[model samples]
Target: MDRKRVNACIEEIVKARKADGGLKQVFWVAAGGSNGGFFPAQYFMDRESKSLRSQSFTSNEFFLAPPSSLGKNSLVILCSMRGTAETCDAASLAKERGATTIALYIEESKLTEVCDYSFAYESISYDETEASEMNASYGLFLAMVLLKKLENYEHFDLAIESFSVLDRVYRDAWNYTLPLAKKWAERNKNESVIWVLAGGPAYGAGYIFSICNLEEMQWISSPTVNTCEFVHGPFECTDKNLPMFILISEGRTRPADERVLAFLKKHTDQNIYVLDAKELGLSRIDKRVSEYFNHLLFSPILNNVYLRALAIAKNHDYHYRRYMWQEKY
Candidate 1:
């Protein structure tokens, strides 16, 4: 684990936050990589508090909610790996509109100047989790700490306990996923894209996991399809050669997994990578409690690990900041 880098990043966020007043009354905004996991971490703070909210936007894009309750009482804590135009534009807008801007990015580029305070993790290096992966994990944990300090949640102890379980789940899951990742690397066979399917709590996870375009190791496009949408339209076109990867996490959305698997079976010709939760063999089920949080938190952790392993399997350097050149929006 890059604890030194992680600790430094956490300390930077805390220090920058202190300089900008404090995080107790701020909106932690994140898009792109951490959008899946860290966003939920921010959202963990009860919505009624008027102190926290996570802004989620379209793929390859970042959005600013119309200046509502956020202008006066809130500051913007934006996270981006590459510091692309989408993130830069959003941060610029937030800063312009009187929001104290704080950025958690991998490289200190344009965003560093635009933001009032910037915490760039210069130590994480290229062949690791980079931006999204690290940001997601850190974002959630940081959000929890901030919320506990500010918000008056009675179940704080339980929440923290549950949160601690997430790391073990990811580590356990990686054990099983490593072999699958290797298989995906050895047998990709020039496949251009990988379709990831999920809905409910895993819906957001599916979206982020599917859209890992920032990593340059594999030109593999990951598009998340609505479980129902696949049955209606994309299912007909998919064949054995064109495979899709489905994320099956256990929860209320378990039924969606069955439907997705059934559909895949019907289209047996297409290559299918089923990233099931059981296969991951996570150590604790407590981490699996929140469909929303787990998908965002755990999935990215798994992704960062896989991204590193995949890069190694293919002998390529892995860095999100370097891949920023190709991001158009």
Candidate 2:
């Protein structure tokens, strides 16, 4: 929560990139939930910025098959809650290749030491306490600031101002959504399989919820598929008793989500839980900016909080794991 330090670090990055032929590309490098958090930022840059090309890669893949686009004018951002070995190796490689490296971590470790710039946020921890939502928010803020500096984005000020009151928004969202989450958990506690669907930036939320929370934490069968890709093959698996969760983004691809929702409703007698970003009252945020960035701000927190409630209802602990931190990979 050291806003001043974060600002200073971003300022230095901006200054350095400006001096080094004006930052041609940005790579968000990490793995698992950490890499999932970067998706919204990549989506934002793709939609809003013209000059800066943004992409995300898992640490293992980046280390084995380095991108041809990575070079002196590239800004590489690596994130890890615990600063895992793969992340550290990837950061070291990117640094050695002359890319400007920034490490965002919850705790100090080897990855932090290898980067040109490092940021540690005490409020965002690498645990099963539903804190990854806050971590994603911080990630989006850092990405937005970088984009603002590079492109002079018109809506950056409003976005930052809105985020200043995000604590209150988060509280309100939890209060409003917790009851619904609990109800869904109670009803579906015995279900064997679940399908999660999302499109656009909200895909990150779906990925983390299905993979990190449901599958990894609760040991459930939850396969996340993009709404646009549902009809290709995944949609055929739907049945009357199956459970589905849909995360609807408020951006350009919302119509695609709506199309899938309508199809599911018409074809299946199963329960379909829809958590739409438009329902959250982001009172302080501008409507235009909210439409574009609300998925990054709202979806992860909602899904994280909902998954916590599901864990409770299923008589499972969110922190319980078979191999995650209990054994070495």
Candidate 3:
């Protein structure tokens, strides 16, 4: 991947926005893993940009009831690993509505043909889990570009530098997580149901792992809830024998997650598994950026890898799916 080219493309988009008196809104549209990948970026924009409005939507939802705010002064980002039919239709709708559309994908397809700008990453023989993480990285880049234009986004340079070294960071994260993943898998292999929890940016990681990887791929019953929401009602579902997985973010939301963890430890005798991003030694990543983005970057990828281990431990292939590409949905 040429970092220079990515930067250039971002600059082009920024220049266009400036020439048009600036973009008023941004929409992130996708489905399944791709929709999951948009969460952190959406979070970043919400937290960092004061002037730009951003929203995320499932591809079909966007096409069915398009936002009234979407127009020539809006930017719409679409994602599709294989360019799904729904996403392609949404991109075409976005373009027809006069929004500056950008498609981030791994291949050239209907999505690329419909968008005003398309960025394609090198195609790899990676499963949906791996592709989700890769797409998240691309989404983060898009977020940063918009952030740079909306506000100076003080940490932009450091964030880009940190992203460039994520390959190494991912390796270290996997090395640290492997044994733990295997152990967790062994304990939960026979369990009928499990719960996953996270807060803030890490919520996306928890959601995707539980829904896309565990439930969808492994045919396990898993429910994911925001950590902050745990105490409201979901706490009633906890018990001594239940299994729970918690993803602890390293950012401001850490306290929210810690509060949930403390309550769970004190109240339930259930088996609990926790993965904290701060503990992952991601070399070369900026400390502050790591605090904000590590949970988003590390948790999902690590969870995917962990699921693969769990699949192997249970004598099941992670790629096994009932209705994924094998059957019509």
Best by lDDT: 3
lDDT of 2 by residue, 199-295 (tens): 8878887888888878887788999899989989888987888899998777678898999999999998469988877676553456766654555
What order do candidates take by lDDT, descending? 3, 2, 1
- Per-residue error at 123 for model 2, in Å? 5.3
Give the better candidate number (1 or 2) by lDDT.
2
The Cα RMSD of model 1 versus the native structure comes to: 5.8
The local distance difference test score of model 2 is 0.78
lDDT of 1 by residue, 157-254 (tens): 65556545655565555565667677765665355666777765556667666665322345567667877566778777677877676777666666
Compute each candidate's TM-score over C-alphas.
Answer: 0.69, 0.91, 0.92
TM-score of candidate 1 against the unseen true structure? 0.69
Model 2 residue runs over 4 Å out of place are 122-133, 296-300
List runs of model 3 lying over 4 Å from the truth.
Answer: 17-20, 122-133, 282-284
What TM-score number comes out for model 2?
0.91
Off by over 4 Å in 1: 1-31, 34-39, 42-54, 58-70, 82-86, 107-133, 142-151, 213-216, 267-270, 287-293, 296-329
lDDT of each: 0.58, 0.78, 0.79
Ranking by TM-score: 3, 2, 1
Q: Answer with 1 or 3, whichever has the higher lDDT.
A: 3
Candidate 3 lDDT over 25-80, as tens digits, reads: 88999998778878878888878888888999999999999999888888899999
lDDT of residue 316 for candidate 3? 81
lDDT for 184 (candidate 3): 88
